[model samples]
Target: MVRERSSHWNQKCRCLLLGLTVILILGAVVVFAAVILAGRRDPPAELPQWKGRGSTANLEEIILGRCFIYTRIVNPELRKDCLKIWETFKNAFVSKNPCNITEQDYQPLMELAAHPIQCNKTLLWSKTNELAHKYTKVQGNLLTLEDTLLGYMADGLTWCGSPSSSETNYQSCPHWRECANNPVSIYWKMASKTFAEAVCGVVHVMLNGSINHAFGNSSIFGSVEVHHLNPKKVHLMKIWVMHNIGEQPSDSCSGSSIKELKSIIEGKNITFSCEDDHRAVQLIQCVGQPEEPACRVCRTEF
Candidate 1:
């Protein structure tokens, strides 16, 4: 009887210990779940419209101040017409969906700011905005689209209109791909067409040689500008395939895209010539690396 009672007591103790162990494990699990839940955080709220949006004053400064000063210097008659320009610009895109604005919407503003393109001084570029701008500035004779009045006014500014209101949406604007007829892309297309139509004598074209395709068909220079070049007006097209100073370039005047450009120019019956490592482009590259051996011999190409 004593041995049986001892055995029964042992069994009771084992059951109690098992129950305690189960209870402890459940408690640990609850604590772990609570810690995980406590560590999580809520996402931040979207900012209020007033806090996120930009002001019209910034646009006014860009147009009335920088654009006005440049316009006045170029043509003094426009000195007092800065406000008029601003008004015209606002009317072009205001009260309309930004993505819905087309190139024709800017026609009124373009008409107001239009100037005759100088002969033989037109510079067409693709993927060479910085170098081309620098080259034009240094030469002081060649004119890119940016040198024109309309281009100067809206070079890098972004403004959009609303359907419910007549105010500008400075907070967010449609990207270029968001719509086919967006304001910015269409404006450049129109400008490029105008610029190309004015090409005369020996026209200069700047292209980047480091990219996969130096003369992409979709580029403004290729699609719009090149298409507008009148064989009768433009006698010769000089293509400058620019490359980095030290690095060996992937594409050249003989590259497939460039050959395609040549074929296109030839199809128009305009004379075509190309230069690899064009001296002018190298000189622009040399501006930052004047100590380089290649830059030491850089000369102006007329």
Candidate 2:
């Protein structure tokens, strides 16, 4: 009886040991699985270079707000779909390689944001941003790039997106000359083309007389804007070369590039006229610098 009782005790202890071992194994497995799941749920600690580092919310707000304000004031007829416009604009570059973005990427946004351009008032400018805007703002009859909806939203803003993320890089962006088709340059080029195609009747181009290559063939006005103008729709291209209030203009109708530009326009069977030291520009200068000898006299001719 004693021997049988001892054997029973030994058997019970063995069973207990086995059960404890199984429980320990199961618990370990559960812990390992939980650790793995927790790791998977966590976000990456480091981001890749291609991933954009900034948010475009501010830019979007600017664009949307401007759209509402400008559309209401400038052209109430344009139905303002701010959200849809933002989505289309963002989708063009967001989660895509910044350098890989092409002019066609912006097509949807361009089509969605189409607004009418008044005929005979479209003004194209090269190296003359401030002057051109001042002229347009005061004149009221003329409209430059910034006067347009798209141009107004994108003016002086730099942004880009990455292929792995849907955020715009507000901190740093590709320089304009970094590549032939950088995001900003591509957008403007496409916008310029759209603006140019809408031209009808007389079109004025403001070229800076102080700069060399005033009519640069590679400029947005030269390459994109000049190319899309249809002779049938556009009757004349008035070249308004602005100079210092009382200085000899560096470029004129006889200048090589200007002459080439004239030839290009005439080749398309459109009449071309160039005026050096435009009177209106000189008068604008006089308003700002009324004390200067040049401003005091305010002569279109030097």
Candidate 3:
């Protein structure tokens, strides 16, 4: 009888302990759920706009600014799955400018990105600057002549001669004469055309146009596959501006940054968008009609 009573007490104690253990586990799970919910709070919203000061052509500044935003702000600050994010927008800017390529074989530059980025930046800046300077010099002379004539006109000075003198309105200056002898008129027309055509025309092409040599059918730049390898070592290959005929330095880390586990990129296409939009439009207008500027509408073609 005593053994039976002891067994009953022991069983009751075991049941109580098991029930307590299950309660503690259930309480822990609830607490864990609450903590997770608290941690998730609200996500941050994107900023609406960017700020800067400077007169710009619009297209150039906007495009460059977008690149800056990607390099300096978006790419570094975001800690999300970088490879997946990268693949989403790698060639997005190209949608705005089709000339800009989308898919690139970036296997070569993985070694470079893991380390310092300064070396590559230095090399690209040097080339872009060199070419920009050369372009400036070539166009400077022509632009100067245009500037001088423009100044003269703003002051109401005419090379053809005295603003047409009229008695009906004596205070009014004489209009520029259409007479043949005036050297000022002759000189103005000559200088105006000289620089405007020779200088500004090339400027239009370099800044907005490209001689696309590669990966197209009979394009002006012609099958443009230029390979420039090893900066510190011997530069056996030709070096171009920031954009090469073939490979570009910015493409170095683009590969490792692109691929992700869940996403298969074999033949899949990603439609790209620009986070930083430098909406610059290029419009070329001539002072006179078709004769003065042969390439009057100089936005796309040279």
Per-candidate TM-scores read: 0.75, 0.84, 0.19
Candidate 3 per-residue lDDT over residues 1-302, each given as its tens digit: 99999999999999999999999999999999999999998865322121211112332334334434544563454233334332322222211211122223111111111222221111111113334344334444322221222212212222111122211111221222423222223233332323222221111112111222211222111111111212232212112212322223342112222222002112222221111111111112122223343324457756
Residue 92's lDDT within candidate 2 is 86
In angstroms, the error of model 1 at 236 is 1.5
* Best by the TM-score measure: 2
Candidate 1 residue pairs in clash (backbone atoms < 3 Å): none
Cα deviation of 107, candidate 3, in Å: 16
lDDT measured at residue 238 in model 1 versus the true structure, 0 to 100: 90
lDDT of model 3 at position 144: 25
Clashes of each: 0, 0, 19
Model 2 Cα lDDT, one tens digit per residue, 1-302: 99999999999999999999999999999999999999889584332343333434488888778778877877777786878887888888887777789878999988888677878988899998888888888898998878888887788776787665667766555665556666777889888888888879999998988766689988888888999998889999999888776566777666888989988999999999998868787778788778867666646976
Which prediction has the highest lDDT against the true structure? 2
Stretch of 10 with least lDDT, candidate 1? 46-55
Better TM-score candidate (1, 3): 1
Clashes of 2: 0
Please provide, for model 1 over 194-254, each residue's C-alpha lDDT reduced to its tens digit, 9 standing for 90 to 100: 6777668889899999898999999888889999998998889999999877877889998
Kindly indicate the candidate among 2 and 3 with the higher lDDT.
2
